[model samples]
Target: MEFRCKKAGDECYGVKELTLLSEISQRLIQTKELKNDLSVILELLVRHLDAERSFLTIFNRQNSKIYIEAAYGYSSAQQARGKYDLGEGIIGRVIELARPIVVDKISESNLFLNRTQQELKSKDGKDLTFVCVPIIEESQVTGALGLLRLYNPYITKDENLYLLSVIGSLISRVVSSKQEQMEELEALRQKNQELQSKLDDGQRPVNIVGNSGKMRDVYSLVNMVAETNSTVLIRGESGIGKELIADAIHYSSKRARNNFVKVNCSALPDSLIESELFGHEKGAFTGADSRRKGRFELADGGTIFLDEIGDIPLSTQVKILRILQQREFERLGGTETIKVDVRIVAATNRNLEEAIEKGEFREDLFYRINVFPLYIPSLRERRDDIPLLVDHFIEKFNKRNGTSVKRITTSALNMLMIYSWPGNIRELENCIERACILTTDDVIHSYNLPPSLQTADSSNTQARGGLMYTVEQVEKQLIREALTSTKGNIAKAAELLSVTERMLGTRVKKYEIEAWRFKV
Candidate 1:
C-alpha cells in the first residue's frame, strides 16, 4: 500500500492505485455478468484498500428501499440485514445527498448505524474508518458503495474518500447497464401480457380448471407464447401441473395437428437416454436390434416435451443444446446429421440455476430452452382454486368409477382448504378420488378424507378439542344426516343411524336438534 502524494491541482491516483484501477477495469470488461463480476470487483477493492469489509448497495426505485447487492467479507445473513430506506443510515444518506461521506473513525461517529452488527475495531487496538460514495448514473443517484478499514493517523480521510469515489464511478457503469437490460426485458414481458390479455379476454385454458390470480397469470403466459415456435421452460414443484402447462402450450400452437412427443428424462437410465432421445442405428449398442426413430425425429414439425429436464446427463446436454440452436443432431453411432424442426418444451422441478453453479447442469442448454419461461404456481399458493379443482376431479372420478356422488359437504371442503397440498394438485386429486370411493351417501364427509388431512396443523380441528371431541362432532353430524333422511321421524332416524331410540333421543336432546324442520 504505497502512494505518491496528491497532486497540487488534480485528484489523481498514485502508480499502485493506478495499477489497481486498471486491473479492476479489465475484470469488469471481461465479464458482463453483473452479480458475479460485482463480487469480484468488491473483493479487489477490499484487498487493494486493505479494508475489513466492503459493500455495493442498489436502490430499487420501485420499492424505495436500498439493499446490499454484493459484499466482501460479509456473511449472507449480514448482507440481508444491510438494508436501509432513504435518509436512514450511512449508505442511504450517501445516496440521498449524492455525495461522498468519510468518517475518520467509526467508533467516534454517531452517524455510523452499524446495521450489519460488525465490530468497529481492527485486530489491533485501532478504530475503523468508514467511507461511502454515491453511485450516480445519468444524473440520478442509483446506489452507494462503502468501505471499512482500520484507521490510521498517517492517512487522510480525503484520500480514502477520493479512492472510493473513483471506484464508485466504475461500478455505476456496470449497475446502470444491468438495470437497463432488466428494464428492456420487463417492457417486453409487459407488452406480451397486454397482448395476451386482449386476445384471451378472460378466457381460461379449455383443459385446465382454475380462476385464481396466479393461475390467470399462468394462462396469460401460456396464451402469449403458444402461437410461436419459441422453446418453453416450465418450472415448478413436482405434481404442480407442469406437464399440463406443456400440454396447453403444445395443443394451442400451430403444430397441434402434428405429433407431440414426450420424454421423461428422469425415468430413463443414463445409458438409454441418448438412444431414447436421438434414436440409434441398427446394432449401435448391445440392445440395439433395429433402427429406431428418436423423439426429436418423431416430433418433426411439432413440439417435443422433455419432462424432468434437470436430470439429463451432461454429455446429452450438448446434443440438446445443438438441437435447440441448429435443429439438427446425428443418431447415436451414425455420422450423418439429421435435420428436424421441433419446438422444445422442457419441465423441471429441480433448481436448474443451482445445478449450473454446482456443475451438474449446462448453462448453455438452460439459456437455449428458457426463451419463454412459465412458472406454475404451487397448489398451496393458489388455495382459492382448490374447490374448483376439487369439483373437476370429483366429476372426473365419478364418471370413471360409475358413482353418482354429488358434492362434498362443507366440513370436508373446509379440511381440504386448510390442509397444505404439499404434493400439489396431484395429491388433491388422489385424496378426492379416495373420498369419492369411500363415500356411502351422495355427499362426501370430512371423515371420508384421508387420516393425513385430519392432523392439527392441516385442519386445526384439534384446537376445538382432542380426539374424543372430534369423534363426538362427527357422531352428531351423522345423527343429523340420518334424521334429515328420515324426514324427522325419530324411530326411522334411530333405525337409519343404527342406534336405539332411547340412546338417539338422549343425544338429540344433548345436541338441541330441531327435528321438525326436516319434515316433508
Candidate 2:
C-alpha cells in the first residue's frame, strides 16, 4: 500500500511508513493499558523499519534521568539495563539537545556510547545505522525514541529521520497524557490518606466517659476544631467534665507532642493573676522571687487551659485581650515584648453573657475566646449515662482502694438515679468512693450509701405514700403530666418518662385516659 503525505511535504509512497503509522494509531486508540500499547507499537516499528532493535525511553522529571520504558528484540534483563543520565549516551544526547541524530556507522561517531551493550552488527558483517529523535512536547524535549537498523543504500538518511520524527511526536502526546493522569490519581490518593489519618487521631482513646448523643456531638466538635489553632471556650456547670473536653481537644490536635499547661483562673489572687499568666521578672513584687515563666510562655507551641475564665479580674482581662489579639505580651516588670504561639482553650461555669451585660467581663475578650464554643451537658440532662458512670466509678474505686466491690445493688442504683446529681460527676465519684469504703460485702446495698442519700430516699418514700393516693393513681398523674408536656405525642411522652412507647400505652390503657384530649 502507498499513501500521499501532506505534512511530510514529500508526496511519499512507502508501504513500511504507511503501515507503521496506521497500526500505531489504531492500537493506541483500542488499548487501555499504556504500557502494553507502547510495547506493541515498538515491536511493530522494529519489524516494519527492518531494524535490528528499537526502544522508547521516558524522562523522569523527579530524578532528571531517562530509562528504557519498552523495547523489541531485547530480553527483559537487557531492557532493564538501559538507564541514562541526561547527555550521557546517544539517546540522552538527542534529548538534551532537543534534536535528532543519525550515525551512518555506529563505530565512526563518538556520541555512540553503547550504554545498553546491545548488538550493533548486521548479519552481512557491515556496520549498522543508529537513529535517535527527541520526543518534543510544547517545544521542550521530554524523552527520546531510537532504533538500530542495517545500512540501506536505497533509503536516504533524511527520509528515515523524517519518518522517525513524526512517530516521536505521536508518542510524546500519549506519554504526556498518561503521566498527567497518573499524577492526578496519586494526588487524590494522598489526600484521602491524610483525611483518614485525621479521623483516626480523633477516635483515639481519651479518658472521658459516656456515649450519649450529647457527648457524641461534643466529640464531633472536638474533632472538627482539633486541627486548627483556634481559641476554644468550653461552657458548662462545674464538675460537668469541661476540663476533660479541654484535654481531649489538646491531645487530639496537631500539637499533641508539645506541652499542655493548665491554670485555675479563680484560684489565683487578683494581685498575682497578671504575673501568673504573663510571667514575672525578678524583683517585680515585694516577694522579689526569681523570674518565672507563666502559663502562656510555658505552653508555647502547644495549648493552655484556663479554668474559670470568668473569675479573672477586670485589669487582667485587658491583658488577656491583648495577648489574644496580638499573640505578644510582656512580663510584669520587663520591657521585652514576648511573642508566643500558644493555643488557648478556656473553660468557665459562670455565665459570661450575664457577666458581659453587667460589665464584669470584657466583651472583646469573650468574643475572642468564644471562636469555638463546646457546651458539655449536665448529668441531669444525660440521665441515661448515669449507670455507665456508676460502673466506671465502681471499677475505678475497686482498683484504687484494693476493694473487691463487684457492683451496686438495684435499690442503690435506683436511689442514685432518682436523686438529682447537683454536684455532677465529681460529686457522684466521691459518693461512690465513700460507699465503697463503708460497705462490708462485695455488693453495695442501699443502706451502705451515704447518710444524705439514705435520708433523701426515706423522704421520697414517705412523700410518695403520705399523699393519700394509691400507686396507680400516682402513675396516672405522672403519665398525664408527661402527655401534657409533650402535647399528647406518645413517642415524646414515653421519652420524657424514660419508658418505651408500648409501656406508656399500657399505662394509659390501665388508667382509661384519653391521650388526644391533652393536645391543644
Candidate 3:
C-alpha cells in the first residue's frame, strides 16, 4: 500500500509537471504579459486537483502585504483578499515552513494555527479536506496555494497521495518559470544599460543627456576620446550638463581608477588663473608660501577638466597654449621645467573659432583642443527626452527626499511637455526637487505645479477668448501661453507646461517661432 501511495504521488506530480511545462511554453510565447495568464492557470489547477475552493495568495515582500491574485470555485464578490499574518493561518504555516501541508480532516488537525479567533471560526457548512502548499521559487516562498472542498472528500476515488504531490509540484514549476522569465527580461534590461553606459567615457563631462541619435554620437565620441590621451573640446549651451559628460568620459575609460581634476578657467581671478592651472613655487608671489600641485600635476596619468575655457584672458591663453604644445611648464619663481602627461577636456558656451577669428583666442590653441570635438544639442534639440527626463527626475528626487511620489498626473505631464527648456536638465532637476519638497499628495496634479506654469490657462483664455482655433493656432497659442506663463526659459517652460524640451522645441520649430533659438 505504501508503494502504491508513493507511485500515485509521483504520477500526480508528473501530471502537474506537464501542465506547468505547457503553461511555461505559453507564457514564454506571450512575452511580458504575465498576470492575466496566472489566473486561468490557477483555476484549472484547482479543478484538476479536485479541490472545491482554491486561492493563489502572493506575498508582496516589498510592502509586507498579501494579495490573492487568482481563485477557483469562489465568487468574486466573496472578498478573496483574506488577510494572513506572515506566520498565522494554515496557509501561513505552509509559507512559514516553506513546504506543503496535506490534511485528511481540518477539524482534528492542529493546522488552522493562527492566533486569531477570526481564522479559527470555520465558514458555515464548509467542512472539507484541506491541502495547503507553499509556492517556492529561487529558494523563496513567494506565496501559498490551497484548496477546500465543501461537501465532499478531497482525495479522488483513487485515494492517491502521489497525485496530490504531483499537482503541487506542477504549480511550483509554473511559479518558477514565471520568475525565471522575469529574471531573464531583467538581465536583458541590464545589458542594454551597459551598452548605454559605454558612452560618457572621456574628457570634459559631456553636455548631452539621453540616448537619441545626436546624444549617442556624443557618447561614442566621448568613448573614442577616452581611449587615448587627446585634447577634447565640448561645445554646448549653459546648464546642458557639460560637466556630467566630462565626468562620464574620464570615469568610464582605462584611467577610471585615477584622479580627475577640474578647473573653471572663468571662475578664477585673472591674476591667479595661470598659476592656479600650472602651479606656483613657494614665494612665487604674495600667497605662494607652500609648494602646491596644479590641476595638471594632480591629473598626471589621468584627465583634467577646463570649464568655460572661452573666458580665459589672452595672457592666460598664451600659457595654456604652451602647456598644450610643449607638454611642459615652469612654475612661477622656479627655473625648473616640469613635464606632465595629462588628458585635457575643455568646455565652452562661446564660439571659440569666432574668438580666434577676432584674435582674442590663439588659432593654434583652438585647433589643439579641437582634436576631438563634441557639440551637444541644446534643450530645444532633443525635446523627446523631456518626458523620460521628467520621470527620471521624479524617481531621483523621490529617493532624495525619501518620499513615495508615485506618479504625476497626465495633465501635469502634458503641461511640462509643451514648454521649452532653455536651462536644460539643471532647471528640470530643480523644478522636480521643488515639487518633491512641496507636493502633499502621492501624485503631483497639474494644480500642484509652480505658479509660472499655472498661468498658461489664463494666458490662453485671454488670447483666444474661447474660440475654437485651428491646429496651428491652438499649437502656437498653447506653446505661447506655456512660454509666457513660465517665462522664456525653456527648461522652466517645459517643467511648468509638464512637457519635454524636445517636444516643446519641435512645436516652436514647426510654427517657426523665432524667439527661442538655442544658444550655448
Candidate 1 deviant stretches above 4 angstroms = 1-202, 456-520
Q: Against the hidden reference, what TM-scores do the models get?
A: 0.51, 0.52, 0.50
- Ranking of all candidate structures by their lDDT, best first: 1, 2, 3
lDDT of 1 by residue, 22-92 (tens): 98889888877888888888888877666788988887664355778889989997797776767877887
Backbone clashes under 3 angstroms, per model: 0, 0, 31
Off by over 4 Å in 3: 1-209, 454-520
lDDT of model 3 at residue 84? 56
Model 2 reaches what TM-score against the true structure? 0.52
For each candidate in the order shown, give its overall lDDT on alpha carbons. 0.82, 0.80, 0.66
- Per-residue error (Å), model 3, residue 43: 52
Q: Please tell me which model should have the higher TM-score, number 1 or number 2.
A: 2
- Pairs in clash, predicted candidate 2: none
State the weakest 10-residue window (summed lDDT) of model 3: 113-122
| lDDT score, candidate 2 | 0.80
**Top candidate by lDDT:** 1
Which scores greater on TM-score, model 2 or model 3? 2
